[model samples]
Target chain A: MYLFSAHNITKNYAAHTALKNVSIDVSAQTIFGLLGPNGAGKTSLIRIINQITAPDEGELYFNGEKLKPHHISLIGYLPEERGLYKKMKVGEQALYLAQLKGVPKAEALKKLKYWFEKFEILDWWNKKVEELSKGMQQKIQFIVTILHEPKLLIFDEPFSGFDPINVNLLKEEILNLRNNGATIIFSTHNMESVEELCDNIALINKAEKILDGKVHEIKNTYKANIFEIGYNKQEINFNEIVPQSYEILSDIHQNGISKIQIKIPADEMPNQLIKYLIPHMEMHSFNEILPSMNDIFIQKVNEQKQKSF
Target chain B: MIFLFKKLTNRSKNPFKSITMKKIRLIIQREYLSRVKKRSFIIMTILGPVLMASIWIVPFFLATMSDEKKVVSVVDETGVFVDKFESTAKILFVYETDLEKSRADLTKEKYSAVLYICKPTNSIPDHAMLYYSDKSPGIITQSYISNAMQTILKNNLLINAHNISKEDFDLINRTNIKLNTEDIRTGKKSYTEIKTALGIFSGILIYFFIFMYGAQVMRGVIEEKTSRIVEVIISSVKPFQLMMGKIVGIALVGLTQFALWILLTFFIITSLQIAKPDVFKSPKTEQAFDAGQKIPSADQIQLQKLQNQEIKEMLTGIFEIDYGLMILQFLFYFLAGYLLYASLFASIGAAVDSEADTQQFMLPITIPLLFAIIMSNFVINNPDGPVAFWLSIIPLTSPIIMMVRIPFGVPVEQVYLSMGLLILGFIATTWVAGRIYRTGILMYGKKVSYRELWKWLRY
Candidate 1:
């Protein structure tokens, strides 16, 4: 069952429609990635869910209950642009913000300490936030955002400032959070992270969701029945045995091996291509390849772009 | 863990209370802590009291420091007023020959300038002419010479008329009558009562500065709101709580710093009491110190008293100050009066995002404060009168006006009425300000004119 759902959400900024009937059903205990380029109404939709803003026409349900003001306590939001009182001490600011999220003082501290230690920012706790480096500050911010052990967590560009080591640490922690019953919405421009982390994705472009499905399924749906045939120093002709619908994308000799990548139309499959190609050429290797999520994303966006014309 | 604890404790109490009060406390705390914690607060707080106490000592020290012998050279060309300029203090006299040389020489070496006295010339517009260059002779020297010269001239005329000896004239020298205030009410209502009223005036001055500046604090919050920091804070807490927390925090800071100031002042006055007891002492207690030291004699006191009637009347109820009441009313007015202004300021702050934007609505709030200050002066001048009655009843101006009248003794009814009005003003202003604050907090980059602000009030 879905733990969080935003149905038919729409938001208008005067003459501009920021979000139009955007919907998502985020399942519990999974990382549901929100992938979109800048200004695709993701922030507007997130704001509606967080209750920072009200949608012009939509409703959100959380944990099978209609979302209310008090439901804000159930969701932890780490905004893209960080806001921390510069003059306030790190610890003091963290506890204050956590308490504002409705966490009791003693309990908030216990959780905050656990996260601070896990993040190794406990020593920097006493110093004023302004004194900390940007990365360190982001870590502190992350700790406070999740200190309440919120049921659902929203992080926009959560790994923006982390180095390689910290990035791995954050990834481990994010997975840990999901394992601990927190559904997550992670939004970013980093497509590699999406491939590595996301269980499902809703890709929005031009304030509309263009693709919404399991990541692997979407990638598979975009894959052409293509095979890379390799032979040593072979001259190949495609017109006779290969169907006219088949297309040669690349035919190159690399490191003394003749290789050719061909695409078959939807009516044809890679097995049929392999069957037909064996009789026509001295085939060294034949393989079918799946498209990357990056390719699918770009392809789908381009499809939308083309459809607009 | 500890970090979270500190933050919670440091954060204002649960932010879900009334917003204006919250904002006031926050801003007051911010101003108080930021200002009080600074080295400047320490220095100024200590300096204010020290300066007040030294007022009684510094003048005497300055008077003593300036006691060098000041010479006066005179040439009585008309011979009408001769042998007039003589003094045994800092001013001394020497007669010099050649008027031109004396004038030049005196100007060169600072001989209190030469006085070239001439009899009333027919062509001269002024009846008497005394020539000096670029300086008034020090008062002591000028008074001595002018007195001696006038006495000599008068005696000459008297001798010509009646042929009396100088001794007879000296023995019977008499002046005109003098008028001085000897209040019919005595004992508990004497000089101390007058001094207490003066103290009350000081208390009122403090209330004004706080009231004025406290409103500034409110305006500052509203300015910040207009700028959009309120949104940044509101993201974490409820609007009302945010408002109340800020107000309480700021008030605490103000109280802390103010308490520190009072303590510092007490130390300053106490030190002065230990160091320079003569001035701080009552005039009666200091009579012994005046022995053979040129204290005002009975005739002189009477004349001085006649000349200073205006100051005496202004400070008439000075000795009747109620210290506890002054403090209590101060706190009441401070909170109520500041809340009233701050509520409006917070509304303005929420409505507009910047100081420039706030100007369009600032006058509507500020004019009343300015009027209060102006009206207070009037109330002090005419205590217990009709104008004072109306001025003291209006809450906006009442805090200052009533305090000004406190020295003059306002009726108990007026005080309670004024207090009630001030509180009512706080509530009404808060309601209005809250409306503006709620709408304006989220509105950004928009110019909020007074008309817009007024509309916000309606909405």
Candidate 2:
């Protein structure tokens, strides 16, 4: 079942359109990556989902119900440029934000204590936000964003300011939240993290959703019929052994092994390439090559750019 | 379950109504607490009463504190003004026969100035000259000497040329006329002076409160924007709610400070009065105390009794004003005026990325307030005139101009109309400001212009 979805979303500012007929459906308890380049309407769409700004034309549903103001209480949003009140005490600000989301003060305090202890920032609770380091402040912001235990959390570039270790910790916590039935909408240009964590993704470019599906399915759909072969070099000549109909992208001879990348014909199966290659040489390895999300992101955006021109 | 049922019903009726009040309350609570807990707010709260009390007490102390006495040597060539000069606490007069000797003594710093009265070429002396080395005589001293000479010469002329006796002259000069004004409708003594003072005091107080608290609202908005917390905040609450919550919260802060100041000032003044009853005595009584060595004659005692009666009448005049109505109107105008301007300030703060960029937007907002203040004197002088009537009716200037006219017995209908118009104006400005603020807070790194703001309004 879909946890949240935006249908035919359209938004415009005075000078230009921010979004155009975009649609997205995020399934329950899945990490949905919203990928886009700078100024690509990802923020606009996220804001629409958060109800920070209403879409000029669209309908949004949460848990199969039309989105309303009350839905805000169930959703936590960490904007790209998120911040806390600088002069406010860390714990006080956290509790205030939680209360703003409709969490009672006692419950908020209880949750804050748990999170603060888990994040090892309990000592900094009484310190003003300005006195904390940037990473520490970001941690506090992260904690405040999720303190209400929202069902749907939207984080825009959540790992931008964090050190690698903290990023991993945040990643683990995000996964843990998902494991506890919380759905996450992650927006970022960090394709590696998308590859590592996202179950599904929608690629938006120039205010249009050009691609979206399960991450593995997208990688599979974008993958060319290409395979890499690693075999003993002294035993065979790669050019002579491979069929002339096949396209050899690159062939390299290093040490005692020869590795070559070749594209199979549409009629052939992956096993066919392995079967054809195994007869000629003692193969060490044979594998089909799948595209990375980064490669597909670049290729799709570039293709869209060319099509527009 | 009841919460869920209510939420469902509210959603069906109006989708945006759910949780708004709670969120706004949270925002207000945070805003109020953060400010009230600040060191500066505490300092100002304590300092405000002291400053106000000092404004009343400092002048009295300064009046009683004696200054260095200035001595003037009189060299009357006419010999007709001897023994006529009177000495006050600050100035003393002494007669000298030799003009050259007086001049020499002045240069030697024996006297502050040497006043040389020329012999009369006609009925009155044509001119008089004053000489000193470094320090010049004050205007008060110069006028006092000239007045003394003029009075003595006039009496001499009356006695010699007109053949009038001193008794007849004294009796004719003592024909002092005093006019007591009464309101014809109420048949009560009218206190125009006290009413004018009250009007000006309240008007100026409201004007100051609006600016001081309005700027605070703007700064608070700017702080939220600069810190980049506005996005997170608006995600939870509507921008309008956030803006209003801040405005209302800061207004409460202003009211609290004002209430504390009034109470503290009253307490301090009363305590001081009780601790040293003599310090709180009337200035006339204080003067009598200053001249402790002199025993008051029968006439002096009668004059003091008359002064005491006048003081009592003044106190009755102060109590005669409808303080309840005046205070109610003051609060109404204070909140109305502050809300009107604070919304504009919030929008300006949202439109700019920094405080430095607010100057351009601040001009238009400040102009009406300044114009109202500038026209207040005219309004006070001619409360029933056309200029005052129109200014009091216009919402932008009414908060101050109407206040200046209120104490002078403004018609109830006109006050009602002015108040209704002010509320409408506040609503209109808040609508425009909320529109601008919603768009402006999300926009960054762009230098917003008037055109951009216009576009934001449309958006």
Per-prediction CA RMSD (Å): 6.5, 3.6
Local distance difference test values of all predictions, in order: 0.69, 0.87
Q: Each model's number of backbone clashes?
A: 38, 0
| lDDT at A45, model 2 | 97
Report DockQ per prediction, comma-separated: 0.19, 0.61
True contacts kept of each: 0.08, 0.80
Per-residue alpha-carbon lDDT of model 1 for B256-283, expressed as tens digits?
6567767877787678678866554444
lDDT of 2 by residue, B1-459 (tens): 336534654553563454677778888888888999999999999999999989878777776777788888888888777766656666677899899989888889999998898887886675788897886777877787778777777888788779998779766665545567898999988778888898888888988998999999999999999999999999888899999999999998998898899899999888887886666657666555444344654545666777787788889999999989988999999999899889999999999999999999999988988998888888778889999999989888889988898888899999999999999999999999999999999989899999989988987
TM-score of chain B of 2: 0.87
Q: Where's the lowest-lDDT run of ten residues in candidate 2 chain B?
A: B289-298
